[model samples]
Target: MKAARIHAYGDADQIRVEDAPIPAIGPDDVLIRTVAASVNPVDWKIRRGYLEKMLPYDMPLTLGWDVSGIVEAIGADVTTFKPGDAVYSRPDIRRNGTYAEYVAVRAREVALKPTTISHVEAASLPLVSITAWEALITTAGLQPGQRVLIHAGAGGVGSIAIQLAKAKGAHVTATASQGKTALVRSLGADEVVDYHNPTAFAAARDMDIVFDTIGGDTQDASWAMLKPGGFLVSITAPPSAERALAEGKRVGFVFIDPNAAILRDLAQLVDGGKIRPLIGGEFRLDDAAKAQLASETGRTTGKIVIYTGQP
Candidate 1:
C-alpha cells in the first residue's frame, strides 16, 4: 500500500510518500481502504514530533487522524460492519493512523458514514465532531435556551460545535473574524463576535457555557463571558483552577475518546441532516505536507482533507 509517512519528525518538509506493506488486522480490527482522510492540526503536531514526549510515533509514522472509506475486510471478532459498508472515523491516536490506502482500525472506533454527503465531506467530521460532541454534550452539558460561546467559531471543531449546540436548542454565540460571520451564522450561531474586540466579551456576562477551541488569550478571555454557575469547557488544553475559582464556575477539559457508541450517535446526526461536515480544501493524499501547511495557517474555516488512492 502507498502511504504518506514521516521517517523522523521535524517539519512538514520531512513528510514523504512511500510504499509500505498493507497493515494486518487483529481480531477486533477492521481494514479500511481509505478514499479520503482529513488533516487535523495534531497530524502536523505529531509529524513534527511535538507529541514525542507523550504520543511518540514509530520510526516511519502515518499521521492522518480522519478516515472516510469503504470497509474492505473485517477482522474475525468484528460484526458491527462488513465489506462495502461506507464508513468513517478518527481512529485511536495510540496506533498507526489513516494516511494510507489501507489502515486497520479498531472495530469499536469506526462508524457508518453519513449518506447525505460524499466520502470526502464525511472524511472531515470524525475528529472535530467527536471533540465537539464530547466537549459540549459530555463535559459542559449544554442546555437548551442557554447562552454558549464558542471561540474559533469557523474552525473544524467550532463549526460543528455551533451546529450541535444549536441542534440542542442552545443560543450560540461564536467568535471569529468578520470573514466567517456568515459561515458561522449559517451553522446557526445566534451571534458572531469579531475576535478583534480583544474585549468583545468584556462587558458581556452570564453566558451559560463557553467552549474554548482556541487556547492562549482566547481561552483566558472566556472566563468573564460565563454566568456564575456556567461551565467553561476546553478541548485545546486544561483550564487553570485559580481562574475557574475566581470566576465561580466549573472548569472542564475534554479529551475525546473514540467510542463506537459515540461515533454511531454522531453518525446519525450526519445521516439525519442535523450536522454537516465543512470542508475547507482537499489535497491528494501524497500532498500531506501541503495539508499540514494549510492546517497551521489558522485561516481555513473548516477541515482540510487528503484523498488517498494508491497511485
Candidate 2:
C-alpha cells in the first residue's frame, strides 16, 4: 500500500509518499480501504512535532485522523459493520492514520458514512464536525434561543460549528474576514463580524457561548464579548481557569475524543438536510504535503480533502 508518511517531523517537505506494509488490525479494529481523508490544522501541527509531548507518536507516522472509507475487513470482536460497508471516523490520533490506501481504526470509532454525500465530502466531516459537536453540544450545553459566537467561521471547525449551533436553534454570530463573511452567513451564522475590523467584536457582545478556534489575542478578546455567566469553549487551548473564575464565567477546553455515537447523529443531520460538509480543495494522496500546506495557510473557506485513488 502507498502511504504518505513523515519519518521525522519538520516541514511539509518531509512528507513522502511511499510503499508501506498494510496495517494489521487488532480484535476490536476495522481495516478500512481508504477512499478519502481531510487535512486539519492538527495534521500540520503533528507534522511539525508541535504535539510531541501531548500525542507522543512514533516516528514514520502517517499524519491524518479524518477518514471516510470502505471497510475491507473487521476484527472478530467487531459486529457493528461488515466488509464493504462505507464508514467514516475521526480515528484515534495515537495510531497511524488515514493518509494512506489502508488504515486500521477501532470499530467503535467508525460510523456509516452520511448517505447524502460522496466519500470526499464525507471525509471532510468527522474531525471538524466532531470537534464542533463536542464543543457546542457536549461541553458547552448550548441551549436553543441562546446566543453564540464562533471564531474563524470560514475555517474547518468554525464552519461546521456555525451550522450545528443554528441547527440547535441558537442565535449564531461568527467572525471571518471581509471576503468570507458571506460564506459564514450562508452557513447559518445570524451575524458575521469582520475580524479584521478593529471594532468589529463590539457588535458581538452579550453572547451565551463563545467558541474559540483561534487562541492568543482572539481568545483574549472573546472574554469581553460574553455575558457575565456565559461559557467560553476553546479547541485551540485551555481558557484560563483563574480568569473564568474572576470574570464570573465558565470555560472548557475540548480535545476531540472520537465518538461514533456523535458521528451517527451528525450523519442523520446531514441526511436530514440540517448540516453539510464544505470542501475547500481536494488533492491526490500523493500530494498530502500540499494539502497540509493549504491548511497551514489558515485561509481556506472549508475543509481540504485528500482523495486516495483506491477502488
Candidate 3:
C-alpha cells in the first residue's frame, strides 16, 4: 500500500509518500479501500509538533482522521459491514489513519456514506460534522427558537454547524468575512456578521449558545454576547472557567469522539437534504503535503479533500 506519513513531527516537508504494508485489522475492524480523505487543521497541527504533548504518537504516523471509501475486507466480528459496502468515518486518532491506499477502521465508528454526495464530499464530513455535532448538540444543547452564534461560519466545522443548528430550528448567526456572507446565509445562517468589522458581533448579543471555532480574541469577545444562562462551547480551546462562572454562563470544550450512532443521524440529515458537504479543494493522494500546507493558511472556505484513486 502507498501511504503519506511523517517520520518526525515538523513541517509539511516531513510528510512523505512511500510504500507501506497494508494494515491488518482487529476482529472488530474493517479494511477500507480509500477513495478519499480530507485534511483538517489538526493534521497540520500534529505534523508541526504543536499537539505532541497532548496527543503523543510514535514517529512515522499517518495523519488524517476523515475517510470515505469502500469496505474491501472485514474482520471476524464485524457484522454491520461487508466487502464492497460504501462507508465513511472519523477513525480513532490513536492509530494509523486514512492518508493511504487503504485504512483499517473499527466497524463501530463507521457509517454508510450519504447517497446524495460523492466520495470526496463524504470524506469531508466525518471530522468536521462530528466536531460540530459534539459542540452544538452534545455540549451546548442547542434548542429550537434559540439564537446561536458560530464563528468562522464558512469554515469546515462552522459551515456544517450552521446547517445543523438551523435544522434543529435554532436561529443561527454566524461570523465571516463580508465576501462570504452569502455563502454562510445559504448554509442557513439567519444573520451573518462581517468579521473584519471591529463591531461585528456587537449587535448579536443575548444568544442562547455560542459555538466558537475561532478562539483568542473572537472567543473573548463572545462572552459579552451571551445571555446570563447561555452556553459557550468551544472546539479550538477550553473556555475560561472563571469567566463562565462570573458571567453566569456554561462553558464546555469538545474533543471529537467518533460515534457511529451520531454519524448515522448526521447521515439521515444529509440524505434528507437538510445539510450538504462543502468542498473547497481536492488533491491527489501524493499531494498530501501540499494539502497540509494549504490547510495551514486558514483561508479555505470548506474542506480540502485528497482523492485516493480507488475504483
The weakest ten consecutive residues by lDDT in model 2 span: 195-204
Task: Name model 3 segments beyond 4 Å from true.
Answer: none
Model 3: per-residue Cα lDDT over 1-311, one tens digit each:
89999999887999999998899999999999999999999998888999888888987898799999999999999899989899999999989889999999999999999888999899999999989998999888888899999999999999999999999999999999999999999998999999888776678799989988999998998898899999999998899999888889999999988788888998899999999999998899889999988899999988999988664
Cα lDDT tens digits, model 2, 121-235, are 9999998998999999999999999999999999999999999999999999999999998888889999999998988777679999999999999999999999999999999
Candidate 1, overall lDDT?
0.87
- True-structure RMSD, every candidate: 1.5, 0.9, 0.9
lDDT of 1 at 185: 93
Deviation from native of the Cα of residue 232 in model 1, angstroms:
0.7
Ten-residue stretch with the least lDDT total in model 1: 197-206
Best by lDDT: 2
Q: Count the backbone clashes (under 3 Å) in each candidate.
A: 0, 0, 0
Put down candidate 1 lDDT per residue, 1-311, tens digits, no spaces: 88898898788899888898899999999999999999888888888778889886677887788898999999999988989899988898988888889999998899888787888998899988889888998888878899999888899999999999988999989988988889899988989998886566575567999998889887888887888988999988898978778768899998776766777888788778889888899899778889889998988978898999631
Judge candidate 2 at residue 145 and give its lDDT.
100
Q: After superposition, how far is residue 234 of candidate 1 from its true place, in Å?
A: 0.7
Each model's lDDT: 0.87, 0.93, 0.91
1 or 2, greater by lDDT: 2
